[model samples]
Structures are given as C-alpha cells and as structure tokens.
Target chain A: MLIVGGGVVGASIAYGLAEEGAKIGILDAEDSDFSASRGNFGMISISNKGFNNLAYFRLSYASSRLWPEFASTLREQTGIDPAFDLKGKVYISVGDREFAAHAEKVAEYARRVGAEYQHDILNRADLRQMLGNVRLGERVTGGSFSPLDGIAEPLKLYSGLLNAIQRHGGSILRDHRVGRIQHQRGIFTVEGPWGSLSAPRLVIAAGLGTPDLASQVGISVKVRPQRGQMMVTERVEQSFPYPVSGLLRQNPEGTIMIGVSTEEVGYDDRTTVSVLRSLAMKAIERLPDLGSVQITRCWAALRPRTEDGYPVYQESHERPGAFVITCHSGITLAALHKRLLPQWILGGRKDALLEPFGLGRLQSASAA
Target chain B: MRPPHDLPEPPHQVSFRFGDEEIEAWEGETVATALLASGVMITGVRAMSGRSRGPYCLIGVCHECLVEIDGLANQRACITTVRQNMKVCRQTRLRPLTGEDETREQ
Candidate 1:
C-alpha cells in the first residue's frame, strides 16, 4: 500500500492500515509546502461542518465519535498526547434570533439524518461563569454544543501519527514530493525525485497535490486552496474550557486562540494587519478581558478545500484501486482515516454513499 | 456554549517568549505573565506603521505581540508558547530596505 502526503490525514490512515496488519508506505513532502496539519486549528469541528451537505455531517460525526479512543490509542502506542478535549464546542451567536435559526438548522438536519443533536442557550451572566477569565458582551448570546465535537493540537496529532505509523511498520518518506502517479494494468506507480514506488493499490492524501497526481490518470479534482489565518496567544491558563465554534479553540495551554478566516487568496498564505486586527477585536468584543492578553503567534495555512469546502473521497474510474481523499478538515477527519478508511483501502467494501463527496460534485454544483 | 465566550476552565499547555527570554505556562496563564516572567518587553521593530505593539491579549486573539519565529515571519508572540527552544526574531522594523533590490541600477 502506498500513501502520499504524510500529514495527519495520511499518517492516521497509514497508521490505521499498518496497525491492522497491512504494509504501508508514505511519501511525505518538502518543508516549504503549506501543511494544514502544521498550521491547522485542530478542532474536531462538527457544529456546521457540512451545513449544506448531510454526508459531510455524518462523516464528521463518525470521526468525532472515534476521536477519544483513537487519540488514546495513539497516545498509548506513541506516548504522544494530542490533548483530546471534549468539554464541548460553543458557537457564539449575534442574537437569540440567530441562535434559534442555527439551532433550527441543526435540529432540522439532525432529524433529516436521524442523528441526535445536543445544545443549550446562555445569557451574559451564564456565559461569564463558563469562561473563567472571559468578559462577555451584552449582545452576545450562548451557543450550541455537540458531545461528538472537540479539538486537539493538529501538529501534535500529525507528528504522533507519523511516529506511530512508522513504529507500526509503515515507511514514511519525508521531504519527498511526489511528481507523478502512473497506473498500468493492475500496478500503480508513484514517481518522485527521491525514488519511485509501484503498488497494486495507491492512495493519494496530498492536500493540494492530489489533483496533479489524479490527473496523471484520467481522474480530475476540483480541489482548490482556501487559506485561513489564525492568531495564537501567549498561554493563559485554561482560556476556555471547551473550544468555541467558528474556529476558536483554547489549547490546553493558557491562551485564547482566535482565528481561521477562510479566503480564496490563491495560495498566498500571508497574514495582513486588517484581517488580523479585525479577528482579534471581534473575539475581544465577546471576551473583552482578552484585550490585555498578549498575542504570541499569527500565521496562515492553505486549507485543502474542495469547491464546496468539504471532503472528497474518490476512486478513479480509469484506474481501479486508485483513490484520492482530500479535505480541509484533515484534523477532524483524522479519526475516520484511522479507524474506517483502512477497509476501503484494502479492497474491502467501498461505501458508495461517499461518492457524493467526490470532485464530481464540484462540477455538478458549478453547472447548477 | 451559546455565546462561546462562556466556558469554565479547560486544561492545556504552551510556551511564551519575549525576545530571547521564555517561560512555561498553563492552560489558563495569559501571555502577559509568560513575557513579564521572562523580562522580554522591548522591541527593535518600531512599528513603521501602526502603534507600537507588545504583549496584549495573551489569548491569541490580538496581534500586538506578533513576532517572527523560525523562517515563517509575523507570528503572534503572545498566542504561541515557547516550544523546543523556538528561534524567535522580532518583526521587521523599518530600517530602509537594504537588500540587493534597494540598489536598483539601470
């Protein structure tokens, strides 16, 4: 088995397969590339993950459920704790009306998909007690919480998966950028500067590199770069018990994380003062006390976004056993890649339902 | 959390630094303490444009304390903790571009 791109998604998948008694080889990338795993906010995001797509919601929920066990398993195996926190994810709202509308959306989607939804409402006073040092705004209403949603440090998770998979007999070829993937007859070949790999089954999890690899065959993907900028604060003790929705997560370290503005910046992962200031001030309005807290880091990373900003799981029509899996929420889906995806990779039953998530959706959506 | 602003104490860890100094912090410790403890509040960068910046918003929400670490420039110093002897440098202070491009000859 061959896996391209050794970030959290690929590493987790490779680790899962290797642990499950499958031979796995990973071709990692060079340092300069935009690794969502390195700069990801690490939210096991489930709140409005697939607001328009129900399949995404289901896939995200499954990954969320498998998070704790998967995190612990990797921790136990590699002694690298990804800091799985599930106090809950809260989505602050503009007003009660907005809250109700979002709640209605989730509730309606839950009923439609037969998935249970959980949430609560809180006023200013209620909110203050919840955020230890946070100062709440008067207009700020409460948010929705999902037991199945949480966060982890994406970098830690990526590194852990890399180590654990390697420990479990998976080979990782870091700093090797894959240039081409050619398939002939029943064999799939992956070529790069360092070397080339030939296998019956080939898996491409390279964030933005998937299209180039897929196009080598007859498959094409609509995957595009969606850059997100995030600001990290100096560690403040327990900034928030649980992560807040809208891409704000308080890491285990004492610091409030503000971030993750999604933009179509064409792979330019550079931060700007206007956007950074806006994000900081917006977060401060809700938690005014953070005004004095010192911000420590601000950076941007390109999200491997499909046109609709969701995951794409595809098997090439021209090349059998050739698959491409890409998503902006690599951290959130890390668990699924570990626990479930190995089956699909091993020539096991393919879940046809995932077909809706393929790049073909981008074409149809564009046409519509 | 309906407002997301409300939340009890959650646990976490991270490092903070000011210039060459650094400190260990908890999930609840703001970057201010981390910087003050290490005594790194001065800056060579004079904020060529906006107001002078420093550690303000230990909660990663503010850009006041942004610094450059590793080769990646413009990192929020207050939001990130001092991890693995991270090589941190101050943001570019307007010292007039001195690179090869500045000496443009026909």
Candidate 2:
C-alpha cells in the first residue's frame, strides 16, 4: 500500500492498514508545507461537527470512542502520552436567540438521524455550579455539552501516531514529495523526488494538499483552506475541566488555552497584535484570574475545509482500489480512520456510512 | 564610487511580495511570521464586513491567516515558509459552491 502525505491522516491510515496485515508505505510531503495536524486544538470535538453530515458525525463519534484505547496503546508503544482527556466538552452561546437556534439545529439533526443527542443547555446558575469561576458576558445565556467530547495533546499525538506506525511495521518517508502517480494492471505507482513506489492501493492524506493530488489520480476533493488562530498560555494550576472552548480549555498541562478565531483568509497564518490582544482579552474575561496570566505562545493554522464544510471520502470510480479521504476535523476523526478506513482499504468495500460522501455530486462519475 | 556612511540600512529584508505591495520578509521564516515581524498588521478583509482582520492565532487553527500564494488561493501561509521569489496575496472574498462541482451536497 502506498500512502501519500504522511501527516496525521497519512500516518494513521498507514498504521491501520498495516494492522490489518497490509504492507504499507507512507510518502509524506516536505515538513515546510502547510500542515494542520501538529497545530490542532487537541480536541476530539463534536460541537464543531454538525448532524447534517451523518458520515462525518458517525466517523467523528467512532473516532471519539476509540481515542481512549488508541492513546493508551500508542503511548505504551511509542512512549508519547497524548494526554487524551474524555471529560466531555461544552460550547457557550452569548445571546438567547443564538442559543435557542443552536439547540433547535442539533436537536432536529439528532432526530433526523435517530441518534440519541443528549447535549443540554444550562442557565447561568446551573452553568456556574458546573464550572465555577467562569464569568459570562452580559448576553451570554449558557452553553451545550456533549459527554462524548474530549481533548488531547495534538503534537504529542501526531508524534506518537507516527512512532507507533513505524513500530507497527509501517514506513513513513518524510520530506519526499510525490511528483506524480500512475496506475496499470491493478498496481499504483507514485513517483516522488526519490524514485517510483508502487502498491496495490494508494491513499492521499496531505492535509491541505489533498485536492491537487486527488486531481492527479483523476479525482477531485473540492477541499480548500480556512485560517484559524489560537493562543496557548503559560502553564498554570488546573482550574477547570471539559474544554471550555469558545472561551477556554484548562488543558491537562494546566495552561489555559483560549480564543480560536476563524477567518477565511485563504492561507495566511501570521499573528497580529489586534487579533492576539482581542483573543487574550476575551480569555481573561471568561476567567478573571487569566488577566494576569502570561501567554507563552500564539499561533495560526489553516483548516482543511470543504465547500460545504464536510469531509469528502471517495473510492475512484475511474480507478479501482484507490481511495482519498479529506476532512477539516482531523483530530475528531483520527480514531475512525484508524479503526474503519483500514477495512475499506483492505476489502475494497464501499462503506455504507460513507456512501453520501462520494464525488458523484461534484465531479464526474469517473472521478467519484 | 558611492557610499553613504552617515546612514544605517534601517534593518529590512525584501525577500517576498504580496500582490503589488512589497511584503518585507526574512530568510527561513514562514510568510505569516515575516509579514508580522515587518509590522504588516491586517491580512485579508472580511467578506461580510470588509473590515481589516489581522492574524488572531499564529497557528492555522483559527483560519484567520489565509493568503494566496502564487495561483493557489487559501494556502495557509503560517506553515508555508517564505521562499525566495514567492508570491503572497491576501484573499478577500466569498464564493458559493455549485452542486455540479461537488460529490456531496453542500
């Protein structure tokens, strides 16, 4: 098996395939390329995922479920503890209208899919009791919580996944860019700067680079980049749990991380005073104690986004045994890729759950 | 034949450009960081508000720092370093997705 783009997605898929007894080799792009996995919010999040896309939701849920076992196993094998925290999570709304609308949105989505969505809304008093020392904005009504949600150490997980993949008999060739790909007689050939590599199957998972590569194999992802910025504060005392996103997350490291502002600025990932100040100020508002907290580092990353903001998974209608999977929420769905994609990769079975993600809706049937 | 001993270089690097504007940047630095280090505050303007939004998070998580590089629009310049002779442009608009152009319905 040949996997291109050896980031988290590439590594995980390769490891999963290897676990299923496939000879897997991953060809990763140059590290300098725009990568998202290393800079994730560390959340195996579900709130950011909507119910309209059932494939994405199911995949995210499956991955969320597998995180506990996955992290433990990887840590044992690679000695890289990802700090996987499955303490449930919340997303707060500032106004009543937004809160009601969001509640209705997820509720209807849950009913449509017949999935038991127990995310609930709590008033300020109830919220205060659940999370002490959180100061809500004047119009801030409350938030929604999903017991299925969790967070992890993104960099550690990325490193651990790569290490575990290596130990599990998978080879990841980094800094080698695949220049082109060709297929003949049920074998795929990926030509990189080093040389030509052939495998029975190929997977492209280079984060933002997935779209152009899919086109090379007669497939299209319609994937794009959306910029996001987040700040990490200095390590402090562990104050709260259950990622206080849209406000803050008191990480296992005891640092209060906060303020993830999303912008659709093609791919600029620079931090500015205006943005950094606003993010820091907002974080301080949520936790008054954070006013004096020092920010250790600030960063911006590009999210791999689809036109409709949903993941795209496809087996080439034109080329058999070749698969392409792309998603904006990699952390939320990493577990699913490790557990599920391996089956599809091996048995050549078109998963029913992912049928809706085919490319027939956008590209020609040949590309789907 | 010509030397200005009375003046310093003002400490600048012109190794990159965004559109017609010269985005002063340094070697071995990501486009985003180089832009910030040069005091270039705002990135692309918002689609709805058209107001200037600078880099919020230095990482690619917030999607606040996306700029066009070469012909590629929406490349995350934070992780993308400023190679010599690279082109960077701030992308500032919204495009709707057509059903015929995608596999899944948006």
Candidate 3:
C-alpha cells in the first residue's frame, strides 16, 4: 500500500495499515508544505458539527468515542501520550439571543440523532463551577456542555503516528512532492521529485494537494484552501480543566491557544493585524482576565475544505483501488482513519457508514 | 565559559531601563541580547495565559522577544537596537492600535 501526504490523515491511515501487518509506504511533501495538521487548534470536538448532515456527525462521534483507546494504543506502542482529553467541552454564548440559538441548535441536533447525542445546557453560574479560577466576561450568559468533545496535542499525535508507523516497518519518504499518478492494469505508479514508485493500491490523503492528485485519477475532489489564523499566548498556570470551544482554552502545557478566523484568502498564509486584533478582542470578551496576558506567537494555516465543509472520502470509479480522503477536521477524525478506514481500504468492503461521504454525493447535489 | 577579562571589550557601552531597572548594553547588541546578558530571561507575560516567556530563538523569527519601547507596544526586541537611555517595558497584553496610532504611523 502507498499513501501520499504524510500529515495526520495519511499518517493515521499508514499507521493502521502497518498495524495490520501490511507493507505501507508514505510519501510526504517537503517541510515547506502548508500543513494543517501542524497548525490545527487540536480539538477532538464533536459539538456544533453536522447541523444538517447526520452522517458527518456520526463519523465524528464514532471517532471521538474511539479516541481513548486510540491514545492508549499509541502510548503503548510509541511511548508518547497524544494528550487526548475528553473531560468535557463548553461552547459559550455571550448574549441571550446567541444562547437561545445555541440551545435550539443542540436540541435539534439531539432530536435528529436521537439518543446518540449527549450535551447539557449550563448557565453562567454552572459554567463558573466547571471553569475554576478562570473568570468569564460579564456578557457570557450561558453555554452548552458536551462530554463527548475534548482536545489533544495535534503535533504529538502526528509524531506518535509517525513513530508507530516506522516501528511497524512502514517506509516514509520525505520531501517527495507527488506530481503525477498513473493507474494502469491494477497497478498504480506515482511520480514525484524524489522518484517513481508503484503499488497495488494508492491512497491520496494530501490536505490541499488532494484535488490535483485526485483529478489525475478521475476523482473530482472539490477541496479548496480556507485559511485560518491562530495565535498563542505565553505559558501560564493551568486554568481550565476542560477544553472550551469557540473561545480560548489553555493547553496542558499552560499556553492558551486562541484562534481561528475563517477567511477565503486564496493560498495566502500571512497573518493580518486586523484579523488578529478581532480574535484577541473576542478572546478577551470571553475571558476578562486574559486582557493582561501577552500574545507570544501568531500564524496562519490553510485548511482543506470541501464545498459543504464536510469530508470527501471516495474511491475512483475510473480507476479502482485509488482512494482520496480529505477533510478539514483532520485532528478529530484521526481515530476513524486509524481504526475503521483501513478495513474499508484493505478488505474492499462497501461500508454503509461511508456511503454518504463519497464524491458522488457532491456530484449529484451539483447536478440537482 | 569565556571569562570577561579574556573577551575583547565592547566598542561602546549603552545604558537602558527595563521596567524601572537600569541596565548596561553593548552598542551593537539588540535589546534581547542585552536582556539575556543581564540574566533577564522572562521578557514578557502572555495576555491570555498570564504566563512568563523568554527569548526562544535569539533570532527575530520567533517574535518571543516582544517588548514595549518608549510606550510603543509590540516592538520586536531581537531586531531593535539598544540605545542609551532606551526605555524598555515588557508587554503584558496586546493593545489594540487605534485610528490615531495608525495616522501617526502614516
């Protein structure tokens, strides 16, 4: 088996296949590649996902549930804890209107998914009890808490996967920017700057590079780059016991990770002062005490997003055994890629769970 | 460690203030280098986490050497040269640049 893109998604899949005693080879781009896996907010989040798409919600929930065992397995194999935390997640609302909307959304999601969805609505007092010592801003009225959502150190997780893949006898080629992929007679030949390699099966999990590679294999992967700017504060005392969604959350190492401005800037990963100021203001509005802390570092990363902001996992119809997997939520979906995706890829099983996430759905929707 | 007596003397010495404390600096050295030479590691406190941070990369790439110089916030200490009587204050939080500040820059 051969995989392009050695990010979290590709690394997870490679790790899975290697664990199953298969010869796995992963070709990674140069260090200069704009990797989302390296710059993500590191949340294993499930809340506020799949507003209309239940399939994505289920996939995310399944992955979230599998995280505990996955973290343990990686730790045992590679001796590195991915810092997987599932204590709980709080999504705060600054006003009554937003709070009511958040509540309604949670209710609707729960009704749609039925008993599978789990969350609790909390007032300001309740939120205070959960977030010890961290003072909330006066405008924060309420929030929704979900036990299923959590966070992890994304870099550590990626490193653990790489280490495990190597330990399991998987070959990883670095600085191999895959150019052309040719599939003929059930054999796939991938050419890059490094060299050309052939395999019986090929998986393209390259983040933003998926569309170009998939097009060669007759797969229309409508994945584009959506830039997100993030900022990190200096390491402070551990404040929040659980990860807070949409607001600032302190990492296990005491540094608070504040993010994420969604912009449609094409391929530009430069941080602007205006966007960064807005993020800082919003973060300060949520946590009043943060007004005194200094921002240490700021960066921008491009996320691979499909048309509907959902994942695209599809096997090429024109060329069999060639699969393209792309998603913006690479950190949250790592467990699924590591645990379940290998079965579908190796056994050629038509998984009903994966049916809704195919490229055909996007094509059909476009046609309609 | 190289002894101070064995090392060549600086071409010129400069004086500066870091949060009310007087310090000596080399003429060609940056503010970050001066702080490091004086054993002042914790340069600034983060706005969101309230944690202390020191210069990580000595180079200007990290932006870990952010300090307020003469009331101007968000100045990079690693790139800014130290001058005599330079008032260097560690930035505790991000101060939003106002319209007047932008106009001043213009």
In angstroms, how far off is B60's CA in candidate 3? Answer: 6.4
Candidate 2: tens digits of C-alpha lDDT, residues A1-368: 88888777777787778877888788877766778775577788865466666666776776787888888877888899888888887666666797788778767766765654556667667666676554555666777777778888888888888888878788888777987888899889988678888988898887788777788778866777777787876444455556776557876535667767777778787767887788876665554555655466788877788777777777777787788888777877777778778888788665676677667656443423
Candidate achieving the largest lDDT: 3
Model 3 C-alpha lDDT per residue in residues B1-106, reported as the tens digit of each score = 1124445753678899999789888777888888988989988887766888778787777777778888776677888889899899988876432222432353
DockQ of 1: 0.02
Model 2, docking class: incorrect
**Most TM-score-accurate candidate:** 3
Candidate 2: list runs displaced more than 4 Å: A95-110, A113-115, A133-139, A363-368, B1-106
lDDT of 1 by residue, A1-368 (tens): 99888877788889988998888899988889987776677888776666677788788877888898999999999999988876677667667887678767767766666645555555556666766665566667765556667878877887788889888888988788889887788998888788888989888888888788877766677778887888986544445666777746765534567888878889798999988998887777666556655576789988787767778787777777887888888888888878778887785656654556766666632221
TM-score of 2: 0.73
Predicted structure with the largest DockQ when compared to the true one: 3
- lDDT for residue A70 in candidate 1, whole number 0-100: 94
- Model 3 spans > 4 angstroms off: A364-368, B1-106
Task: List, in the given order, the native-contact fraction of each candidate.
Answer: 0.00, 0.00, 0.00
Model 3 lDDT, full chain set: 0.84
The DockQ scores of all candidates, in the order shown, are 0.02, 0.02, 0.08
